[model samples]
Target: MQTNQTYDLLTQVQRIASGDESAFASLFYQFGPRLHSYLTGITKSETAEEELVQNTFIRLAASFPVDRNSKSFRLDLPGGQQ
Candidate 1:
């Protein structure tokens, strides 16, 4: 990932760790449509794509990053589209 993109993600992750729901919403709004489109292209099935996106985000939330080092989950999903 680019430095700028990584910084933005870390910013959001930090906010999320601090109990910022708006930051998480910002993440979803910024990435959700693009994820749906990408998943749809790969899966070629609306139902499957939707399910995959939902599952992916669910898994992402379950692995929240706690700090910049060590505890981070190294989220590179879709090459840092968010």
Candidate 2:
């Protein structure tokens, strides 16, 4: 049985795959603190961790295929199909 956190994460993944920014934001908000803690524990550099977090999110956003048919969404991402 999946817990609420797991279930929510799964739902957010599905939404994000369909280019849901809200879902992605939810996922970021949910994971950022945990990721920060883990990164800090390993690297012990807050600046590096912060930069990595932003870069990681930017790369991740670029990687996902945008759903332009999603109610005239903003963000003119290239390399995606309808």
- Model 1 lDDT per residue over 1-82, tens place: 8999999999997887765667767787788899999887699898888778767776766677464443344333343332
Query: Which lDDT value does model 2 have at 14?
Result: 74
Question: Model 2 Cα displacement at 71 (Å)?
Answer: 4.6
The TM-score between candidate 2 and the true structure equals: 0.68
Candidate 1, after superposition: displacement of residue 63 in Å? 0.6
TM-score of 1: 0.67
Cα displacement (Å) at residue 29, model 1: 1.0
For residues 1-82, write the lDDT of model 2, one tens digit per residue: 4699788777877788787767777666767778778899888898888767666666776777767776533432222211
Off-target runs (Cα >4 Å) in candidate 1 are 65-82
- Please give the RMSD of candidate 1 to the true structure: 7.9
